[model samples]
Target chain A: MLTPEHIRDFLDEVKDPEIPVLSLNDLGVITGIEVAEDGFVTVRMTPTFAGCPAMEYMRAEVEQSLKRHGVQAFTVQMSFSEPWNSNKISEKGRKALKEFGLAPPQPYQGILVLDILEYAECPNCHSTNTEMRTPFGPTLCRSMHFCLNCRQLFEQFKPL
Target chain B: MLENAIKDLLYKIADDQLILGHRNSEWTGFGPMLEEDIAFSSMAQDKLGHSLAFYTLLHQMGEGDPDTVAFMRNADQFHNSQLVELPIGEYDFSLIRHFLYDNAEILRFESLSQSTNEEIAKIATKLKGEVRYHVLHANTLVKQLGSATQESISRLQQSLEYALPFALGIFEPSKHEQELIDAGIYSGEAALQNQWLERISAVLEKTHLKLPEIANLQPVYGGRYGQHTEHLQPLLDEMAEVFKIDPTAEW
Candidate 1:
């Protein structure tokens, strides 16, 4: 009776290690979930940044989430077959990021330009009057910006 | 033979990233400004991650695990271009090296994204996006400083001149260069160098910095075949220090 949807539903409880408000499912890193006739499950995930230190932790958390859901005989794998871009973050993920005080990335086309890095809607004031301070941030997935309207420094989930 | 060529290409690129990542880390707390500190540190983390991806690919190609291959190797065994192994001298030098180095790196990854090898292609596709930010940072700073005060412009120009020869060495071809190119594994280093030249020239043109006559300079070769400056061994020693303390230690 267990379906991939059921597996996905169970994974909804697992949040990103760095951004706790965002679930792994909403974060768009859970690339695939499969349930076999033999009652084995396989989960595939990819990193937002290949060097993301949180990836191993996230992978382990996926395994733990499955075990806690009373599922056994599961395997978790990380790959780049479906690489991550900021566009992968679900709308729910974007909402959670904004509510968490991080500016959500602007939906970008397939090509990312320097202009995209400059456009951060201020999470505090919802202001478009912002300037990017630096592309590299405290985390590889975020960039620093300052909002002229809010007069506050903020971080944006960098659009990859 | 084709496999050797591919592995050789992968090793050099991975080593360049790993070594330069370490050098960048040295600026973690030492950058002239806090933004710069965060920038270099973030770049270090990204580069380290990039190196791990390539090392993982090399592992899949039957090399040792990423840890063993990265830590257990001697300086003489590394294949990074000499440009990456040099000491991070001053801010000017580091900035110039970063500008020169990443400009070529971005082009290399862009070209490799179309590689006939699917796995390499996948990694190249994923990484080129991340590296784009590095290029943006480098170009912005290079243009700003290359046109700033007299001292800033002169220092950057001096660093640029000092770094050019080694920058050219990044294109040192392996014996299998032709084989790799002909097989569609890679497009060859010569073509990459030409593209790199155009890209860097375009950036420098926006600033006061002058591009030296590269044709007149002898390229400093040998790092691809394990010839490194005296700086590399010390870097390797420091990098492997903790790992060597207990090779079996787990985090």
Candidate 2:
């Protein structure tokens, strides 16, 4: 009696190739998972950023994870039907991002105002006294920030 | 007819992104500062990805594959505006162009997110989120430098004036504009232009820079119908050089 939950558990083993610390499930990119009675498994994913080079690699990881779990006749699709925003990152994912020394995005409602982007809490010292240095960073989903309190320059998982 | 209209719309937008993305890449190691260097490079990567998304949609609609369509097209075959194809001149000009171009782009995607075409809507929704950061970056720099030292302010002002007419070219009307608007696939270019003007004006107002009276300026047009500056063809050649060497070879 394999369920989508079981499939999800298998996917939990797959981590973001870039972040490494965050699992696909906790990243909230595993948009939909279904296991048909005929044993056809369908896994859907959305990219954290449309330009993320790691998406194709992540899709391949999903397929390999499913295969390792002994599942056959599966289709892994990438789409924007559900689109990815920082809010989609699970509480566990936020914890993982913080633990990785990256500031987790603050949850926001409605439109993402510019103020939210200008502000980031320091991951090292837990200080909100930080200024965004640049919106673009080494990767698509990150922004550079400087913390005045701890005098450290860090990256944040940018709030979309 | 509706499909053709949609394809026409996609082509212009895709071409704009691809050309500007390439221009942004030219700044990879040449930026005035290290942070700006990374910023432009990262933005180049993002725009290239965005162009690929639109090209993929066009392929799904029965066009050639993304690489073929992007790499094989000639200057006269492209539908991008004259604004994007211009060389990234000085850093001030590049920054001003970025500020003007991205402001309009954000508004375009915002409207397109509500498009009746489901696929276009979905892609727009996803892209608009990423573009917010671009707009933020542009506005932030424009404000800071626009109000900075005398040399910086004057340089930015001159660039803004030089880039304005060309920026207006971004909204050149499509031949099937009416049809697309009627089909709800797109909001018409005129409406988009008006919104763009208002938005850019608001941002400029925040700075010491003056918004020139664009009402009297002659816009550089015809890029929508494949008319481009002398700069576009060489750019295409350089961009396609490696791809032409071995089109069949796989990475």
Candidate 3:
């Protein structure tokens, strides 16, 4: 009999299709796990955004991971009710994101301000002397920054 | 009758999102700054996702699959506004257009959230939150750049004037507009535009930019009836380029 702990362990290996560096658990997308009396498993999750394209792939990957572990019946249920926040990302995920060359998200203060430049340390040189290039980066969660010390351009995962 | 009106409404909204999303994605890796590159790409993904949602609704109504409908449509077949199909010119132009378009879009989604059709209403309600952020992003940039240096202010002012005529096309009334309004599917584009003007003017009031005289300028219409600028065909060609080559391939 596969325990819920075993299922969680299996899911921890399922990385996000977009980021790839962080697992679903690391990103805090996995909200609930239910094992029915009839041996059916239900995994509840929420997307980082309502229209995140990677969501379909994430659902499929979860089902595949559970099946690979010899689970006979499983389903991935998606919900937008709880909604996702950047604060859900684990400390391990933040370190991994930084190591992967993408600045991790900071805690948002609920005000729309361009002050991320003041606190965004350059992932390349660890220098605080950086300037924001644009608040609108290549993706919804990122913003661009320039390091004055290293003269390297980098993307900061915007605090949401 | 209601079905036809609903489909028409869905097509225009979906087409606008798909085309603008493609345009926004082009900014990826080429943004003046990494943050902007990411921002455009992020909004691009959101726009694409929103289009997919609407297309899925159409698919459920017996249209072709979302991929086929989105990837196979030609420029003449698309129903987007002329404003979204224009090439994202300079940063100032893109920013100004974003300001104008998203203002109307947020209002559109808010109105649609009350749609009599349950599915459309649910989708709109969920999407309204995302569009709110887009409006926030556009408003913030417009405010900052609008009042910044003389160069920035002048550039934005020029782009604002250039974009207004086309922006009006977003409210070009559909043929079935009356049916849609009667059925309570949407409140119609005219009402949406009135609300949009007030909302956009409020933001412009805080900036150095000025709103153009709408009564004097001719609105560029015909996109809803399938006529489009020459720019749209090339954009469609580029968008379907890869999809056409291997429509069966999964990657």
Candidate 4:
């Protein structure tokens, strides 16, 4: 008698392997869910990046979560037709990212401008007085920033 | 004939991505700044993933499994361009190579997105979006550093000159080039090279750096046919070091 809502609720407990604080639902990676009368469940997902190493781990976690919820046959399907963008990240996810010591993604403006440093508030001190250390970060979606106020170096999830 | 041609094209593309992705990943802990570290790592992951996708296609076409093909290949068996296997010397050198290589790669992916081969075209379409950011990152840095201070500009110029010959080798024609072109699987290295030249020239024009007169320059070829610099075998050895230990043990 498990419904799609119950499956979604179960998935909400599945945290992103890289950013453990954010659930897959919070990150907007889970695109769709279906529950069949025969207790089969299907989840459609998209990766934050085409090559995100965490993807396989996340898929396993999704299946584990659903199976734990007593679903008999389930499948997790990865889709790329829609393409992923940072804009898909929820507001709650942004707040979680900030609280976790990484600056959240800013609103993406069309065409990357070099001046994005001006708006990167420090996750450590919440100060706008930050300098960009590098436009590229340790991961595809992150950038390095230095807070002049707190003197702490932090990573920012760059807006896509 | 077309099958061999297609496999040749896929192997070269996959090998290039795999080797260069490994090189980019080497910057993880050593970037001058954390953002660059992450940027390279991000691009590295994307490149590696792209290689995996192509390898998967090869597997479907009856090649060996992806893990065996990627981790167990000898240096002579690899088909990556020599440019990718070169050591990442300095930020200047890596950045210049990034600019040169990605310009060509983005163009290649764009053309491949329209390939008559549906599978290749689909993968290309998915991958091209990811590479767009890599191109942006490369072009932005090249423009900034290529025109900035005396030190930065001079360093970039030096690296550009040193990397150019190897970069040109990326366009070394495949023996199956005509077959690939005629089959609409790819438009051929010559066409891609021409497009790459225009693209890189457009970016370089915005900077103080000058493009070397490529007409007189001899490309460092042979990589397409498996001849590599001494640097490559060592790199391959290092890559296989951990994988060879257990081949079956999952981390």
The 0-to-1 C-alpha lDDT of every candidate, in the order given, reads 0.92, 0.92, 0.85, 0.87
CAPRI-style quality class for the chain A–B interface of candidate 2: high
Sequence-dependent TM-score of model 2: 0.97
Which of 3 and 4 is ahead in lDDT? 4
Place model 1 in a CAPRI quality band. Answer: high
Q: lDDT by residue for model 2 over A1-160, one digit each (tens)?
A: 7899999999999999889999999888999998898989999999888888999999999999989988978999988889988898999999999999989998999998989988899999999988999998989899999999999999999998
Off by over 4 Å in 3: A1-46, A50-53, A74-139, A142-160
For model 4, the DockQ equals: 0.43
Residues A1-160 of candidate 4 have per-residue lDDT tens digits of 8788998899999998778999999888898899888878889997777678788999999988887877778889986545566778889999999999999877666654446533598988899889876666656667777899999989998765
Per-residue lDDT of model 1, residues B78-97, tens digit only: 99999998999999999999
Candidate 3: global Cα-lDDT?
0.85
Per-residue lDDT of B17 in model 1: 95
Q: Pick the winner on TM-score between candidates 2 and 3.
A: 2
Ranking by lDDT: 1, 2, 4, 3
Enumerate the candidates' DockQ scores in order: 0.88, 0.83, 0.34, 0.43
Using DockQ, give the best candidate's number.
1
Model 4, residue A124: C-alpha shift (Å): 8.4
Question: What interface root-mean-square deviation (Å) does model 3 yield?
Answer: 3.3
User: What lDDT would candidate 2 get against the real structure?
Assistant: 0.92
Cα misplacement distance, residue B75 of candidate 3 (Å): 1.2
